[model samples]
Target chain A: GESVGLHLPTLSVQEGDNSIINCAYSNSASDYFIWYKQESGKGPQFIIDIRSNMDKRQGQRVTVLLNKTVKHLSLQIAATQPGDSAVYFCAETRMSGGGADGLTFGKGTHLIIQP
Target chain B: DAMVIQNPRYQVTQFGKPVTLSCSQTLNHNVMYWYQQKSSQAPKLLFHYYDKDFNNEADTPDNFQSRRPNTSFCFLDIRSPGLGDAAMYLCATSRGGLAGPRGFFGPGTRLTVL
Candidate 1:
């Protein structure tokens, strides 16, 4: 994925409501997918990851769902809070008989929490 | 306890001048990567080092280069900075052979070109 600057899509949800951020990946052979959250002025922090063989994986208060048929991935926050407001990015990579190579990231979504 | 450390959280350089951003890791992972991220955009992979071997992305500009002296440190050098080169530079490390779900990232260095 290329970096197309500015005007990121925004998702606004009331506090305590569940927030779902969606991403459409480019490659069908990508066997690994991960979600990252970036706060203002900070680098992306890894949230959760799932492999192609699994359709869903859950972490503390967060869940990742992958649909390989449509090449779509979604991150769901169980109970949203102001602290959860950040830019969410979904990254994909394929281990094609090589080392764990660089990740290709999708255009991020800016998650905004409402009061 | 920061696993990945990036020096000079902010950098300012003049157009056409050289600038270097540094990253160091304590985890001793064999794979380290550099990514360039502009505001409101996703990070684009610049290059990576596995142990001492360097691999650069095909589309990464010739002006951008990276060096890894050892397993612990990596440097990104921009020989001639353009206004478009200004962005947040992120460093990451992962255990080389796996899917790298545990890749740890640094706090990033934001570059400003005048």
Candidate 2:
């Protein structure tokens, strides 16, 4: 909650290199974690998600790792491209009463792709 | 094919004036949410509508109100805009339940308070 309107930390990676963005969530009760890529002037786009039962999940070019023990989540981007330049947010949610709950987001990391 | 569309990608309103932002989803998601995102910051959920049930975040300002007349469309109204209210307003939808699908977000509307 302290992250409101705060300047995001940045991670700069050379183009075609792999980039890893890390987030440390606050709630241990959070069971669902997601990574979102938000380009300038656009809304947040869902990248990859992993549930608590599994420690790892892979998407097309992205992989999400969850560590419930440390309440940590990370996103690994392979062959980072210029288009991949954006702000990355790691969000956690607690599913209760079998329904949707609001997501609590991290301060976020701005991933910059260098030529 | 556009799944979720938000009108007036850029909106300019005078302070103390009432303005409304709109969102419609073709994904037919059961839950729709409105979020306020400031520059270079994470989004904060204002409220959400699960089907016909309206749920407002406790901290959401009383000036902010939402209406989900039907399943596909939702509206966010600001009674009196202030300079601090200027930010990107995002509309998101999800298939809510035990399965809890990832939310689909629309191209946010950037509101500029004059």
Candidate 3:
């Protein structure tokens, strides 16, 4: 069965420090991966994504690393801020026919930022 | 700015009652999706409408239905609500397949079953 899982359920970091969230996927055929942040009452917000061909992709203050060989993905947040406190989720894109497909999300990791 | 929009941020329905959650996107995306999320859990894909085609996940219950009358609007209908069905429903839109294009999500609607 294809599934995505997180290494940790919760992570705590001080402001200005870096935070890393890890995820492992079972589907070797999955080619695209994404990281999302969800606030207390909001939907998941896109943070960053990485394709299988690319090992790493960087966004503002955030980076996504994908290891296809091990089927592992990680999201690194640099200089963590209080606003970064949220549940982080990793998703694998499943491609079906000729069109885009739905995403399979992993159990989220709660990131807590302390001042 | 163009974005995905969901109406009635909160909803309460009685058990066995029918309810519908609505979503609209101003981005004019070709693909629209509905996801269910419980407490401390990840969003689970329920169904989606690509253009005019409706695709449902295998695990999705027959009690759940969807309608995409046009490109900008999509709806999720629960034929009969259950206590276990209480969860946050999120709507998202994408211009292309999930592999390449970025998807935009709405704030989500919280459903309460009484």
Best by lDDT: 3
Clashing residue pairs in candidate 2 are none
Positional deviation of residue B89's Cα in model 2 after best superposition, in angstroms = 0.2
How much of the true contact map at the interface does candidate 1 reproduce, as a fraction? 0.67
Candidate 2 residue A114 Cα shift, in angstroms, is 1.2
Question: lDDT tens digits, residues A44-92, model 3?
Answer: 9999888788999999999999988889999999999999999999999
- Model 2 chain B worst lDDT run, 10 consecutive residues: B95-104
Best by TM-score: 3
Worst 10 residues of 3 chain B by lDDT: B94-103
lDDT of 1 by residue, B1-114 (tens): 659999989999999999999999998788999999997788888999888878888999999999999889999999999999999999999886754534678999999999
Docking level for model 1: medium
Candidate numbers, best TM-score first, in rank order: 3, 2, 1
Model 1 lDDT per residue over A1-115, tens place = 4322222489999999999888887677788888999999998999999989999999999999998897788899999999999998888887662645888888888999999
Compute each candidate's TM-score over C-alphas: 0.94, 0.95, 0.97
Error of 1 at B59 (Å): 0.3
Higher-DockQ candidate of 1 and 3? 1
* Candidate 3 residue-wise lDDT at A33: 84
Please list the residue runs of candidate 3 whose C-alpha ends up more than 4 Å from where it truly belongs after superposition. B97-101
TM-score of 1: 0.94
Per the 3 Å backbone cut-off, how many clashing residue pairs does candidate 3 have? 1
